[model samples]
Target: MSSDVLVCQGISKSYGEGEQKEQVLSRVDLTFQKGQASVLIGPSGSGKTTLLSILGCLLAPSEGELIINSEAVNFKDKSSLTEVRRLKLGFIFQHAQLLPFLTIKENLVVFARNTGMQADDIEQRIQLLIERLQLVAMAPKFPSQLSGGQRQRVAIARALLHRPSIVLADEPTAALDWHNGQTVVELLLDQARVEQAVLVVVTHDVRMLPLFDRILAIENGIVQVKQNVK
Candidate 1:
Protein backbone atom coordinates (compact mmCIF):
# COMPACT_ATOMS: atom_id res chain seq x y z
CA MET A 1 0.00 0.00 0.00
CA SER A 2 1.11 3.54 -0.68
CA SER A 3 1.97 5.86 2.19
CA ASP A 4 0.57 8.91 0.43
CA VAL A 5 -2.83 9.75 1.86
CA LEU A 6 -3.59 13.20 0.45
CA VAL A 7 -2.31 14.61 -2.83
CA CYS A 8 -3.01 17.96 -4.51
CA GLN A 9 -2.06 18.14 -8.16
CA GLY A 10 -1.78 21.41 -10.06
CA ILE A 11 -4.37 22.88 -7.74
CA SER A 12 -5.49 26.39 -8.56
CA LYS A 13 -8.29 28.56 -7.18
CA SER A 14 -9.58 31.90 -8.30
CA TYR A 15 -12.51 34.23 -7.72
CA GLY A 16 -14.71 36.51 -9.86
CA GLU A 17 -14.61 36.51 -13.66
CA GLY A 18 -12.49 37.85 -16.50
CA GLU A 19 -11.06 41.29 -15.69
CA GLN A 20 -12.59 41.10 -12.24
CA LYS A 21 -11.09 37.68 -11.55
CA GLU A 22 -8.63 37.35 -8.69
CA GLN A 23 -6.36 34.39 -8.30
CA VAL A 24 -6.02 32.95 -4.81
CA LEU A 25 -3.95 29.86 -5.45
CA SER A 26 -1.67 29.15 -8.37
CA ARG A 27 -1.09 25.61 -9.50
CA VAL A 28 -0.28 24.57 -5.95
CA ASP A 29 1.04 21.05 -5.54
CA LEU A 30 1.31 19.30 -2.20
CA THR A 31 1.56 15.71 -1.02
CA PHE A 32 0.84 14.67 2.54
CA GLN A 33 1.82 11.19 3.61
CA LYS A 34 0.33 9.04 6.32
CA GLY A 35 1.37 10.08 9.83
CA GLN A 36 2.72 13.38 8.54
CA ALA A 37 1.86 16.58 10.41
CA SER A 38 2.27 19.82 8.48
CA VAL A 39 1.76 23.38 9.68
CA LEU A 40 0.73 25.99 7.09
CA ILE A 41 1.65 29.62 7.78
CA GLY A 42 1.20 32.78 5.80
CA PRO A 43 0.08 36.39 5.90
CA SER A 44 -3.55 37.31 6.45
CA GLY A 45 -4.52 37.30 2.75
CA SER A 46 -2.00 34.82 1.45
CA GLY A 47 -4.64 32.18 0.60
CA LYS A 48 -3.74 29.80 3.39
CA THR A 49 -7.37 29.25 4.32
CA THR A 50 -8.34 28.99 0.65
CA LEU A 51 -5.93 26.11 0.15
CA LEU A 52 -7.06 24.46 3.34
CA SER A 53 -10.67 24.69 2.27
CA ILE A 54 -9.86 22.93 -0.99
CA LEU A 55 -8.03 20.22 0.93
CA GLY A 56 -11.01 19.79 3.23
CA CYS A 57 -13.37 19.47 0.26
CA LEU A 58 -15.42 22.38 1.53
CA LEU A 59 -14.62 24.30 -1.65
CA ALA A 60 -13.66 23.23 -5.13
CA PRO A 61 -10.58 24.54 -6.81
CA SER A 62 -11.11 26.32 -10.09
CA GLU A 63 -8.48 24.22 -11.81
CA GLY A 64 -6.81 21.12 -10.38
CA GLU A 65 -7.37 17.79 -8.80
CA LEU A 66 -7.64 16.65 -5.17
CA ILE A 67 -6.95 13.03 -4.42
CA ILE A 68 -7.55 11.37 -1.10
CA ASN A 69 -6.37 7.81 -0.62
CA SER A 70 -5.66 7.67 -4.38
CA GLU A 71 -9.21 8.50 -5.43
CA ALA A 72 -9.70 11.66 -7.44
CA VAL A 73 -12.33 13.98 -5.97
CA ASN A 74 -15.24 14.97 -8.19
CA PHE A 75 -16.22 18.46 -7.18
CA LYS A 76 -19.33 18.30 -9.33
CA ASP A 77 -20.62 15.25 -7.56
CA LYS A 78 -22.24 16.46 -4.39
CA SER A 79 -23.01 13.02 -3.02
CA SER A 80 -19.50 11.79 -3.63
CA LEU A 81 -18.03 14.91 -2.05
CA THR A 82 -20.21 14.42 0.98
CA GLU A 83 -19.12 10.81 1.22
CA VAL A 84 -15.50 11.79 0.94
CA ARG A 85 -15.85 14.25 3.76
CA ARG A 86 -17.79 11.88 5.98
CA LEU A 87 -15.55 8.90 5.40
CA LYS A 88 -12.09 10.35 4.84
CA LEU A 89 -11.77 13.75 6.50
CA GLY A 90 -11.84 15.17 10.03
CA PHE A 91 -11.84 18.87 10.84
CA ILE A 92 -11.08 21.15 13.78
CA PHE A 93 -11.95 24.81 13.52
CA GLN A 94 -10.79 27.88 15.44
CA HIS A 95 -13.65 27.46 17.86
CA ALA A 96 -14.69 24.12 19.30
CA GLN A 97 -18.07 24.48 17.48
CA LEU A 98 -19.67 21.92 19.78
CA LEU A 99 -23.42 21.74 19.89
CA PRO A 100 -24.50 23.87 22.85
CA PHE A 101 -27.31 21.56 23.98
CA LEU A 102 -25.34 18.35 23.76
CA THR A 103 -22.84 17.16 26.32
CA ILE A 104 -19.27 16.67 25.20
CA LYS A 105 -19.70 12.93 24.81
CA GLU A 106 -22.98 13.42 23.00
CA ASN A 107 -21.31 15.78 20.58
CA LEU A 108 -18.78 13.13 19.69
CA VAL A 109 -21.45 10.42 19.52
CA VAL A 110 -23.55 12.38 17.04
CA PHE A 111 -20.71 12.46 14.53
CA ALA A 112 -19.67 8.86 15.08
CA ARG A 113 -23.23 7.77 14.54
CA ASN A 114 -23.49 9.89 11.43
CA THR A 115 -20.47 8.12 10.03
CA GLY A 116 -22.28 4.76 10.50
CA MET A 117 -20.25 3.48 13.40
CA GLN A 118 -21.95 0.72 15.36
CA ALA A 119 -23.34 1.50 18.80
CA ASP A 120 -20.83 -0.75 20.57
CA ASP A 121 -17.91 0.60 18.55
CA ILE A 122 -19.05 4.17 19.09
CA GLU A 123 -19.18 3.68 22.82
CA GLN A 124 -15.75 2.11 22.84
CA ARG A 125 -14.27 4.84 20.67
CA ILE A 126 -15.74 7.59 22.78
CA GLN A 127 -14.38 6.03 25.94
CA LEU A 128 -10.93 5.66 24.46
CA LEU A 129 -10.78 9.25 23.18
CA ILE A 130 -12.14 10.73 26.39
CA GLU A 131 -9.43 9.02 28.42
CA ARG A 132 -6.70 9.82 25.93
CA LEU A 133 -7.69 13.47 25.78
CA GLN A 134 -8.11 13.73 29.54
CA LEU A 135 -11.72 14.77 28.87
CA VAL A 136 -13.33 12.12 31.04
CA ALA A 137 -14.84 14.54 33.53
CA MET A 138 -15.91 16.99 30.89
CA ALA A 139 -17.66 14.30 28.86
CA PRO A 140 -20.89 14.74 30.74
CA LYS A 141 -20.72 18.51 30.76
CA PHE A 142 -22.25 20.68 28.07
CA PRO A 143 -20.02 22.72 25.80
CA SER A 144 -21.05 25.99 27.46
CA GLN A 145 -19.96 24.66 30.85
CA LEU A 146 -16.40 23.76 29.90
CA SER A 147 -13.36 25.99 29.82
CA GLY A 148 -11.89 27.06 26.48
CA GLY A 149 -9.03 24.63 26.70
CA GLN A 150 -11.32 21.85 27.82
CA ARG A 151 -13.69 22.54 24.93
CA GLN A 152 -10.82 22.41 22.46
CA ARG A 153 -9.67 19.14 23.96
CA VAL A 154 -13.14 17.76 23.37
CA ALA A 155 -12.93 19.12 19.83
CA ILE A 156 -9.77 17.14 19.29
CA ALA A 157 -11.46 14.01 20.56
CA ARG A 158 -14.44 14.71 18.35
CA ALA A 159 -12.27 15.12 15.28
CA LEU A 160 -10.31 11.92 15.90
CA LEU A 161 -13.25 9.81 17.01
CA HIS A 162 -13.99 8.44 13.56
CA ARG A 163 -10.35 7.71 12.62
CA PRO A 164 -10.47 9.64 9.35
CA SER A 165 -7.56 9.30 6.94
CA ILE A 166 -7.01 13.07 6.74
CA VAL A 167 -7.25 15.55 9.63
CA LEU A 168 -7.50 19.26 8.92
CA ALA A 169 -7.31 22.04 11.48
CA ASP A 170 -7.84 25.73 10.85
CA GLU A 171 -6.32 28.01 13.44
CA PRO A 172 -7.36 25.60 16.18
CA THR A 173 -5.39 27.44 18.83
CA ALA A 174 -6.34 30.94 17.81
CA ALA A 175 -8.80 31.41 20.65
CA LEU A 176 -6.73 29.95 23.47
CA ASP A 177 -3.81 31.01 25.62
CA TRP A 178 -0.28 30.05 24.67
CA HIS A 179 -0.08 27.24 27.20
CA ASN A 180 -3.45 25.82 26.24
CA GLY A 181 -2.66 26.24 22.57
CA GLN A 182 0.59 24.38 22.92
CA THR A 183 -1.08 21.59 24.84
CA VAL A 184 -3.88 21.28 22.28
CA VAL A 185 -1.44 21.16 19.36
CA GLU A 186 0.66 18.55 21.13
CA LEU A 187 -2.37 16.39 21.79
CA LEU A 188 -3.56 16.78 18.19
CA LEU A 189 -0.19 15.78 16.79
CA ASP A 190 0.06 12.80 19.12
CA GLN A 191 -3.42 11.54 18.30
CA ALA A 192 -2.96 12.00 14.53
CA ARG A 193 0.29 10.05 14.76
CA VAL A 194 -1.44 7.25 16.61
CA GLU A 195 -4.07 7.11 13.87
CA GLN A 196 -1.44 7.51 11.16
CA ALA A 197 -3.57 10.25 9.60
CA VAL A 198 -2.38 13.03 7.38
CA LEU A 199 -2.54 16.14 9.57
CA VAL A 200 -2.70 19.63 8.09
CA VAL A 201 -3.02 22.71 10.27
CA VAL A 202 -3.38 26.33 9.18
CA THR A 203 -2.00 28.86 11.61
CA HIS A 204 -0.54 32.32 11.80
CA ASP A 205 1.48 31.43 14.87
CA VAL A 206 5.08 31.02 13.85
CA ARG A 207 5.84 29.88 17.39
CA MET A 208 4.04 26.59 16.81
CA LEU A 209 5.71 26.00 13.43
CA PRO A 210 8.56 23.91 14.82
CA LEU A 211 6.19 21.43 16.45
CA PHE A 212 5.06 20.05 13.10
CA ASP A 213 6.99 17.58 10.93
CA ARG A 214 6.90 20.09 8.05
CA ILE A 215 6.28 23.80 7.71
CA LEU A 216 4.45 25.11 4.61
CA ALA A 217 4.49 28.81 3.97
CA ILE A 218 2.23 30.59 1.52
CA GLU A 219 3.05 33.88 -0.13
CA ASN A 220 1.42 35.67 -3.05
CA GLY A 221 -0.75 32.67 -3.83
CA ILE A 222 2.11 30.22 -3.79
CA VAL A 223 3.14 27.57 -1.28
CA GLN A 224 6.73 27.06 -0.29
CA VAL A 225 8.09 24.41 2.00
CA LYS A 226 9.95 26.27 4.69
CA GLN A 227 11.12 23.30 6.65
CA ASN A 228 10.86 19.53 6.71
CA VAL A 229 12.11 17.39 9.56
CA LYS A 230 13.17 13.85 8.75
Candidate 2:
Protein backbone atom coordinates (compact mmCIF):
# COMPACT_ATOMS: atom_id res chain seq x y z
CA MET A 1 0.00 0.00 0.00
CA SER A 2 1.11 3.56 -0.65
CA SER A 3 2.16 5.72 2.29
CA ASP A 4 -0.04 8.61 1.25
CA VAL A 5 -3.65 8.39 2.36
CA LEU A 6 -5.00 10.28 -0.66
CA VAL A 7 -3.41 10.89 -4.08
CA CYS A 8 -4.59 12.87 -7.09
CA GLN A 9 -2.43 12.68 -10.21
CA GLY A 10 -2.96 14.95 -13.19
CA ILE A 11 -6.56 15.44 -12.16
CA SER A 12 -8.80 17.56 -14.34
CA LYS A 13 -12.49 18.36 -14.48
CA SER A 14 -14.58 19.97 -17.17
CA TYR A 15 -18.21 20.89 -17.52
CA GLY A 16 -20.21 20.63 -20.74
CA GLU A 17 -18.67 19.18 -23.89
CA GLY A 18 -16.38 20.02 -26.82
CA GLU A 19 -16.15 23.78 -27.50
CA GLN A 20 -18.84 24.41 -24.94
CA LYS A 21 -16.92 22.54 -22.25
CA GLU A 22 -15.39 24.64 -19.50
CA GLN A 23 -12.48 23.28 -17.56
CA VAL A 24 -12.75 23.78 -13.82
CA LEU A 25 -9.51 22.08 -12.83
CA SER A 26 -6.53 21.71 -15.12
CA ARG A 27 -4.26 18.78 -14.53
CA VAL A 28 -4.06 19.26 -10.79
CA ASP A 29 -1.85 16.96 -8.79
CA LEU A 30 -2.26 16.75 -5.05
CA THR A 31 -1.24 14.23 -2.40
CA PHE A 32 -2.26 14.23 1.26
CA GLN A 33 -0.03 12.44 3.72
CA LYS A 34 -1.44 10.29 6.48
CA GLY A 35 -2.36 12.00 9.74
CA GLN A 36 -1.87 15.48 8.28
CA ALA A 37 -4.27 18.41 7.99
CA SER A 38 -4.30 20.20 4.65
CA VAL A 39 -6.23 23.42 4.16
CA LEU A 40 -7.41 24.44 0.71
CA ILE A 41 -8.22 28.12 0.23
CA GLY A 42 -9.52 29.83 -2.87
CA PRO A 43 -11.94 32.44 -4.08
CA SER A 44 -15.47 31.60 -5.10
CA GLY A 45 -15.82 29.50 -8.29
CA SER A 46 -12.11 28.71 -8.18
CA GLY A 47 -12.73 24.96 -8.31
CA LYS A 48 -11.67 24.35 -4.72
CA THR A 49 -14.80 22.36 -4.01
CA THR A 50 -14.56 20.63 -7.38
CA LEU A 51 -11.06 19.43 -6.57
CA LEU A 52 -12.17 18.41 -3.11
CA SER A 53 -15.05 16.41 -4.51
CA ILE A 54 -12.64 14.58 -6.77
CA LEU A 55 -10.29 13.90 -3.89
CA GLY A 56 -13.15 12.63 -1.75
CA CYS A 57 -14.37 10.29 -4.51
CA LEU A 58 -17.67 12.15 -4.64
CA LEU A 59 -17.00 13.07 -8.25
CA ALA A 60 -14.89 11.56 -10.98
CA PRO A 61 -12.31 13.66 -12.74
CA SER A 62 -12.60 13.99 -16.49
CA GLU A 63 -8.93 13.03 -16.60
CA GLY A 64 -6.42 11.67 -14.07
CA GLU A 65 -6.38 9.15 -11.28
CA LEU A 66 -7.36 9.42 -7.63
CA ILE A 67 -6.22 6.95 -5.03
CA ILE A 68 -7.74 7.00 -1.57
CA ASN A 69 -6.38 5.03 1.36
CA SER A 70 -3.87 3.31 -0.92
CA GLU A 71 -6.55 1.84 -3.18
CA ALA A 72 -6.45 2.48 -6.88
CA VAL A 73 -9.83 3.95 -7.81
CA ASN A 74 -11.91 2.56 -10.62
CA PHE A 75 -14.49 5.25 -11.08
CA LYS A 76 -16.44 3.35 -13.69
CA ASP A 77 -17.33 0.72 -11.13
CA LYS A 78 -20.06 2.12 -8.95
CA SER A 79 -19.78 -0.60 -6.34
CA SER A 80 -16.05 -0.07 -5.87
CA LEU A 81 -16.49 3.67 -5.68
CA THR A 82 -19.33 3.28 -3.21
CA GLU A 83 -17.31 0.92 -1.07
CA VAL A 84 -14.34 3.24 -0.97
CA ARG A 85 -16.50 6.18 0.00
CA ARG A 86 -18.33 4.24 2.68
CA LEU A 87 -15.31 2.53 4.22
CA LYS A 88 -12.49 5.03 3.83
CA LEU A 89 -13.67 8.61 3.46
CA GLY A 90 -15.70 10.73 5.88
CA PHE A 91 -17.27 13.98 4.76
CA ILE A 92 -18.52 17.03 6.62
CA PHE A 93 -20.30 19.61 4.56
CA GLN A 94 -21.27 23.21 5.37
CA HIS A 95 -24.51 21.86 6.80
CA ALA A 96 -24.79 19.07 9.33
CA GLN A 97 -27.23 17.12 7.09
CA LEU A 98 -28.32 15.09 10.04
CA LEU A 99 -31.62 13.29 9.78
CA PRO A 100 -34.06 15.65 11.39
CA PHE A 101 -36.48 12.96 12.44
CA LEU A 102 -33.91 10.81 14.20
CA THR A 103 -32.30 11.35 17.53
CA ILE A 104 -28.56 12.03 17.69
CA LYS A 105 -27.82 8.42 18.54
CA GLU A 106 -30.06 7.19 15.76
CA ASN A 107 -28.38 9.45 13.26
CA LEU A 108 -25.05 7.93 14.21
CA VAL A 109 -26.46 4.46 13.81
CA VAL A 110 -27.55 5.29 10.30
CA PHE A 111 -24.05 6.44 9.48
CA ALA A 112 -22.44 3.39 11.05
CA ARG A 113 -24.73 1.04 9.20
CA ASN A 114 -23.92 2.67 5.88
CA THR A 115 -20.23 2.38 6.70
CA GLY A 116 -20.56 -1.34 7.35
CA MET A 117 -19.50 -1.17 10.96
CA GLN A 118 -20.20 -4.25 13.08
CA ALA A 119 -23.16 -4.11 15.42
CA ASP A 120 -21.16 -5.10 18.48
CA ASP A 121 -20.99 -2.50 21.24
CA ILE A 122 -22.68 0.12 19.12
CA GLU A 123 -23.91 1.98 22.17
CA GLN A 124 -20.39 2.20 23.57
CA ARG A 125 -19.18 3.75 20.34
CA ILE A 126 -22.03 6.25 20.39
CA GLN A 127 -21.28 7.20 23.98
CA LEU A 128 -17.61 7.72 23.21
CA LEU A 129 -18.50 9.96 20.25
CA ILE A 130 -20.87 11.93 22.42
CA GLU A 131 -18.18 12.50 25.03
CA ARG A 132 -15.44 13.23 22.55
CA LEU A 133 -17.51 15.77 20.70
CA GLN A 134 -19.02 17.17 23.90
CA LEU A 135 -22.44 16.13 22.66
CA VAL A 136 -23.25 13.92 25.62
CA ALA A 137 -26.32 15.84 26.73
CA MET A 138 -27.61 16.10 23.18
CA ALA A 139 -27.35 12.41 22.36
CA PRO A 140 -30.99 11.90 23.13
CA LYS A 141 -31.97 15.13 21.43
CA PHE A 142 -32.97 15.63 17.83
CA PRO A 143 -31.13 17.83 15.34
CA SER A 144 -33.78 20.50 15.79
CA GLN A 145 -32.96 20.68 19.47
CA LEU A 146 -29.31 21.69 19.01
CA SER A 147 -27.63 24.92 18.17
CA GLY A 148 -25.76 25.39 14.87
CA GLY A 149 -22.43 24.57 16.43
CA GLN A 150 -23.84 21.60 18.28
CA ARG A 151 -25.40 20.26 15.11
CA GLN A 152 -22.12 20.57 13.30
CA ARG A 153 -20.41 18.84 16.19
CA VAL A 154 -22.83 15.97 15.85
CA ALA A 155 -22.04 15.92 12.13
CA ILE A 156 -18.34 15.75 12.92
CA ALA A 157 -18.94 12.91 15.31
CA ARG A 158 -20.91 11.10 12.64
CA ALA A 159 -18.04 11.56 10.21
CA LEU A 160 -15.61 10.01 12.69
CA LEU A 161 -17.89 7.25 13.86
CA HIS A 162 -16.84 4.88 11.10
CA ARG A 163 -13.16 5.43 11.85
CA PRO A 164 -12.52 6.49 8.29
CA SER A 165 -8.94 6.95 7.14
CA ILE A 166 -9.58 10.40 5.68
CA VAL A 167 -11.94 13.32 6.24
CA LEU A 168 -12.95 15.88 3.65
CA ALA A 169 -14.76 18.95 4.91
CA ASP A 170 -16.28 21.64 2.71
CA GLU A 171 -16.61 25.01 4.34
CA PRO A 172 -17.48 23.45 7.65
CA THR A 173 -17.48 26.80 9.38
CA ALA A 174 -19.02 28.85 6.63
CA ALA A 175 -22.40 29.03 8.30
CA LEU A 176 -21.14 29.97 11.76
CA ASP A 177 -20.07 33.23 13.28
CA TRP A 178 -16.42 33.92 14.05
CA HIS A 179 -16.28 32.34 17.47
CA ASN A 180 -18.30 29.29 16.53
CA GLY A 181 -16.20 28.87 13.40
CA GLN A 182 -13.04 28.92 15.46
CA THR A 183 -14.41 26.35 17.85
CA VAL A 184 -15.43 24.01 15.04
CA VAL A 185 -12.08 24.38 13.33
CA GLU A 186 -10.27 23.63 16.57
CA LEU A 187 -12.40 20.58 17.14
CA LEU A 188 -11.74 19.28 13.62
CA LEU A 189 -7.99 19.81 13.95
CA ASP A 190 -7.92 18.10 17.32
CA GLN A 191 -10.03 15.13 16.31
CA ALA A 192 -8.29 14.59 12.99
CA ARG A 193 -4.93 14.44 14.73
CA VAL A 194 -6.22 12.14 17.43
CA GLU A 195 -7.76 9.78 14.87
CA GLN A 196 -4.62 9.89 12.71
CA ALA A 197 -6.72 10.51 9.61
CA VAL A 198 -5.77 12.71 6.72
CA LEU A 199 -7.92 15.85 6.99
CA VAL A 200 -8.63 18.25 4.14
CA VAL A 201 -10.72 21.38 4.54
CA VAL A 202 -11.72 23.78 1.76
CA THR A 203 -12.65 27.28 2.75
CA HIS A 204 -12.03 30.92 1.95
CA ASP A 205 -11.56 31.94 5.57
CA VAL A 206 -7.97 32.83 6.36
CA ARG A 207 -8.45 32.78 10.11
CA MET A 208 -7.87 29.04 10.41
CA LEU A 209 -5.08 28.73 7.84
CA PRO A 210 -2.28 28.79 10.41
CA LEU A 211 -3.65 25.74 12.14
CA PHE A 212 -3.16 23.49 9.13
CA ASP A 213 -0.01 21.56 8.38
CA ARG A 214 -0.01 23.03 4.90
CA ILE A 215 -2.01 25.60 2.99
CA LEU A 216 -2.94 24.84 -0.60
CA ALA A 217 -3.91 27.85 -2.64
CA ILE A 218 -6.23 27.35 -5.59
CA GLU A 219 -6.87 30.07 -8.11
CA ASN A 220 -8.45 29.94 -11.58
CA GLY A 221 -8.05 26.18 -11.85
CA ILE A 222 -4.45 26.28 -10.70
CA VAL A 223 -3.25 24.93 -7.37
CA GLN A 224 0.01 25.50 -5.54
CA VAL A 225 1.24 25.08 -2.01
CA LYS A 226 1.70 28.52 -0.53
CA GLN A 227 3.16 27.37 2.79
CA ASN A 228 4.38 24.11 4.28
CA VAL A 229 4.18 24.33 8.06
CA LYS A 230 5.15 20.72 8.49
Question: What tens digits encode model 1's per-residue C-alpha lDDT throughout 71-133?
Answer: 999999989999999989999999989999999888999999999999999999999999999
Cα lDDT for residue 55, candidate 2: 81
The digit string of per-residue lDDT tens for model 2 on 34-67 reads 8889999999999999998888787889999997
Query: What TM-score, over all chains together, does every model reach?
Result: 0.98, 0.96
- The lDDT for every candidate, in the order shown, is 0.93, 0.88
Q: Among these predicted structures, which one has the highest lDDT?
A: 1
What is the TM-score (0 to 1) of candidate 2? 0.96
Question: Per model, how many backbone clashes are there?
Answer: 0, 0
TM-score of 1: 0.98
Give Cα distance to truth, residue 94, candidate 2, Å: 0.5
